[model samples]
Target: MSELGKKIATRESYGNALVELGKEHEDLIVLDADLAGATKTGIFKKAFPERHWDIGIAEANMTGIAAGLATCGKVPFISSFAMFAAGRNYEQVRNSIGYPHLNVKIGATHAGISVGEDGATHQCLEDLALMRAIPGMVVLNPADDVEARAAVHAAYDHVGPVYLRFGRLAVPVFNDEATYRFEIGKGIVLKEGKDVSVFATGLCVNEAREAEKLLAADGIDAEIINIHTIKPLDEKLVLASAAKTGKVVTIEEHSVIGGLGSAVCDILSEKQPTKVMKIGINDVFGESGPALELIQKYGLDAQSIYEKVKAFVKQN
Candidate 1:
């Protein structure tokens, strides 16, 4: 395992990536629903003021505007909290952007319970499930700063509607920016082990990595894989890992029902039929608290994952 680098939020990376892409692609424009600063799209707004639009608090209107921009051959990225971008503007996103198969990128930030003090209403646990249901929508939940920035570039290059999920909390920088490569629908195996395969996405990926170290201390060898792309899931890699280990565990910051865990189960139940375990926000809403404290309360911290996986390995 590589030494963990400084913690940086994926939302920050999303903002930086837009500026980088804006330089190369003049048609790239950013639209935010009165959350430019929080969503980090303000960074892009600063660099290219003319290309950025603040659509007030109207998320649906912003989505419609982005769809219109896509029709004119402009690559528009609509930014907002996940609750609004994916939840409040679902109809517009599905009809205007998704149905038309426009070249629009939806940058949804502050996803999951990690939205912290904002509480359950602001924290969106259903965005992944919602976006994944949309036809022709490419859903991406990057694990770290490097992957988040790379995913932004990939979304800009890919045609059709893309949903990019980002987190406000800073996480461990696991990937080396110099050598890391980000693909649209591929999984990266960070560590190899024979006991079990632990697949993780978003903020949970780094926590899973730390859990792996704890599992190692207890003589449980585990394979850690990063499933950044949730919609066009890397089924090939998923099945291969499950086949190798016969035990699978999926961890995500989103709800267990329609997020990475559910996606993995959908594929495995059909083909591999391996024993699978899901670690995430169960069927419960989150409460207002410190971000890290909320993570621990919800059993999403590194210690919690370690305990759960260790018991899982022992029992099954």
Candidate 2:
């Protein structure tokens, strides 16, 4: 578990990864809708001033520009908050990027309830749902700094429209570079168990790991799987785990209606039927508060997950 005490934000890793990528790829261009500092594209702006573009709060126009750049053989990474980047510019992304299938990487930061003190308007709980709806869009939600760093390189290498989700809170680092590998559409099993399979994505992956420990203490061996990619999901891995455990619980920092929970249910309903429980926001908007407080309120915290899983395991 990250050598026991290292904590880093996924957004911090995204920004630093951009600097490292800038040194290698000359054709890599970054565009931000005047949120370079908040979205952490400021790191790229400082490293390669000529390659970075501040589009001044014009999210839709930024997508258009990135698409145009992509046509000329440039790999453009667009940066903005998830609400504005994915929600505000949905039409542009769908038509300009998705339709054309351009080489554009969208780095969406401040996603979900962890956006803390920003209230419902700033918090984006439906980004995964929105981005996943767009055809050919690669949706990536990195669990920690190490995965976030690797995801940046993977997105840059892949040719198509991609959405990279990053969080504002500093979560515990559970993966080490020496042992961890990031692959698009691949799920990583952190712990193997026979009782129940706990599928989680983004910041909730760490909570699932903690919940695993709590469940183990109570004689429940919970299998924990980290789903870093939401769309083009690892159906084989998910179905195999669910087949073994027979009980499933999905955790995410998104709306329960159309996020990782819905994605898992969609798979299970099609192939193998299993009793599933989804742990996320219950079709409600988030309020202004500390990140940890909001997590507890939404029942996405480790303790809450543990209690819910313990009950679900008993019932099933």
Scored by Cα lDDT, where does model 2 land? 0.93
Candidate 1 accuracy as TM-score: 0.98
Give a tens-digit lDDT track for model 2, residues 109-146. Answer: 99999999998998999999998989999999998988
lDDT for every model? 0.94, 0.93
- What tens-digit string does per-residue lDDT give for candidate 1 at 51-159? 9999999999999899998999899999999999999999999999999899999999999999899998999999999999998899999999999999999999999
Candidate 1 ranges with C-alpha deviation above 4 Å: 1-4
Worst ten-residue run, lDDT, model 2? 1-10
- C-alpha lDDT of residue 24 in model 2: 98
Candidate 2 residue spans exceeding 4 A from truth = 1-4
- TM per candidate comes to 0.98, 0.98
